[model samples]
Target: MFENFDDILNVDDVAKALKIGTSQAYKLVRSGKIQAFKEGRAWKISKLALINYIMNQQ
Candidate 1:
């Protein structure tokens, strides 16, 4: 997980930053593993959420 990022990031950015596939990122968001909200057909993940996810991973 990355700490430096824009306030909000898209699935594409999350996928690249987390080194995971786009679908995997989506799955995380859909499964409530990563905090995110859907906008139309896209998912927006927050930097704080990503940080929380990383912290909780251990």
Candidate 2:
């Protein structure tokens, strides 16, 4: 699991965690596939949410 990630993550963090590009990270968030929310102008994804997504994929 994501032991090094924080409770909340940004696009770059998500990209690093998923081993994907930042653009793809943004697309995942925007497409509602990653379960993110916007805070002001930035998107925020919870570590638990990402875990859930990965679990569902399996």
Candidate 3:
């Protein structure tokens, strides 16, 4: 639903997109394996960074 690069996606979106668990998505963000930024009390991941990570994985 979020299409802009400036938009931030929450853990649930990332998990659903990547087909991973919510806990795993949080772990990736916390561990620096995936890029995320803190917005208020929540973590937000950039669409660009997520795409880059997927590309690199392949």
lDDT scores for all predictions? 0.87, 0.94, 0.81
Stretches of candidate 2 exceeding 4 Å from the true structure: none
Question: Per-residue error at 49 for model 1, in Å?
Answer: 0.3
Error of 2 at 14 (Å): 0.6
lDDT (Cα, tens digit) per residue for candidate 3, span 1-58: 3363345678888888788999999998899888888988899998877877788898
Q: Judging by TM-score against the true structure, name the best candidate.
A: 2
After superposition, which runs of candidate 1 have C-alpha atoms over 4 Å from their true positions? 1-4
Error of 3 at 13 (Å): 0.3
Q: TM-scores of the models, in the given order?
A: 0.85, 0.94, 0.82
Alpha carbon lDDT at 33, candidate 3? 81
- Better structure of 1 and 3 per lDDT: 1
lDDT tens string, model 1, 1-58? 3656788999888888889999998898899999999889878999888879988999
Q: Measured by TM-score, how close is model 2 to the native structure?
A: 0.94
- Name the best candidate (by lDDT): 2
